[model samples]
Target: MPYQWPTLTNWLEQIAQPFYQQGYVILEQAIPADLCWALYQDVQHQQLTAAGVGRQGQHQLNQQVRRDHTAWLNQNNPVQQQYLQQMAQLQQDMNRRCFLGLIDFEAHYARYQQGDFYQKHLDAFVGRSNRVLSTVCYLNTLEQGGELLIYNEQDQLISRVQPNAGTLVIFESCRFPHEVLPATTTRYSIAGWFRQNSSIQGRIDPPQ
Candidate 1:
């Protein structure tokens, strides 16, 4: 049987309400299980490069900050297209309900091997970037380690998320600082951002 992705209407309330009250929301089994499995398989076959910090001119591989491999999601692949489509629906709903004015979303498959970790960081800074919302969709479960730690603006720990297949997390990009703790086993997930168009000087900003 083919996997039928759930429409945003089915889960929008769960996402929108918390996001409205706080700055983030986390949901389990957010995507179809079969779809998550397919995406996991797709990533296994991809050629991933060591991920870097910063963007464009400032981008550089800094293992001290992060240690992971990543491959940008390609819309050409059917499995990836399905996932992207789901995110597209999310983007639309976010704009409609939250007035985020999100114009686009970009994502990449991320793999964290044993002992890999990402240092605490913010996805975007006010007035410095277009990213408005940050997202993470887990494709595989882990027994231990590989927890995502989210912090409040005051630098207090708030949420500790254990990687679980089909879990999705969304948060305001500039309001939260988060990090991936060292993985005891391999971890697979998709990290993404919703952005508003920040075109300037007659040139469109490039996607990362």
Candidate 2:
């Protein structure tokens, strides 16, 4: 089925309320499983630069996954183009409903194989302002050992989200200390952030 905009908008509103109160929300079966897999392949085939430091363990993916990924927002093939547009519209509605100003969706594909992981870190800090939210939609289900762990500032495990193809994980961009658990098999995800124009948005500093 094609991505349904009106239905998605309603779903976003339902999820956004709790997100505002608790700082995160999860939507199950939010996107088509097959389309998500296709986009993952397209990203894997594209040239990827290394995403060092910001990542951990042995993460590997093509160029789109490595650099600032918003540049490829419009490069999808026709069918995938529809999916991308729906995502963009959903993002816009989410921002308006949440009263978070304007939100820009910067999509990224992450590929992690055996022992690959991303160290615990916040989504946006330096060089970006108004980054109020972070979202990740799983492309496929993994065999084992890959989990999205959300932590508080004091390092308490607030939530642990296992991969469910088509489900979306939404959270505050600044408060969560999150990381990808080491992957036993290859894992794919579309990871991105929503940012506003904060005058105090600091310069991009490497994770300490």
Estimated TM-score for each candidate: 0.94, 0.75
What TM-score should be assigned to candidate 1?
A: 0.94
For all candidates in order, the CA lDDT equals: 0.91, 0.67
Residue 37: error of model 2 in Å?
3.6
> How many residue pairs clash (N, CA or C atoms closer than 3 angstroms) in each of the candidate models, in the order given?
0, 11
lDDT of 2: 0.67
Residue-level lDDT tens digits of model 1 in 1-208:
3334553347766898899999999998898878888998899999999999999998999999999999999789999999999999898888899998888899999999999999999998887888889999999899899999999999999999999988999999999999999999999999999998777874546764
Q: Which ten-residue region of model 1 has the weakest summed lDDT?
A: 1-10
Candidate 1 ranges beyond 4 A from true positions: 1-9, 201-203
Candidate 2 has its poorest 10 consecutive residues by lDDT at 63-72
Give the true-structure RMSD of model 1.
2.5
Best by TM-score: 1
For 39-73, candidate 2 gives per-residue lDDT tens digits of 66666675544464433344345433222222233
RMSDs, each prediction? 2.5, 6.1
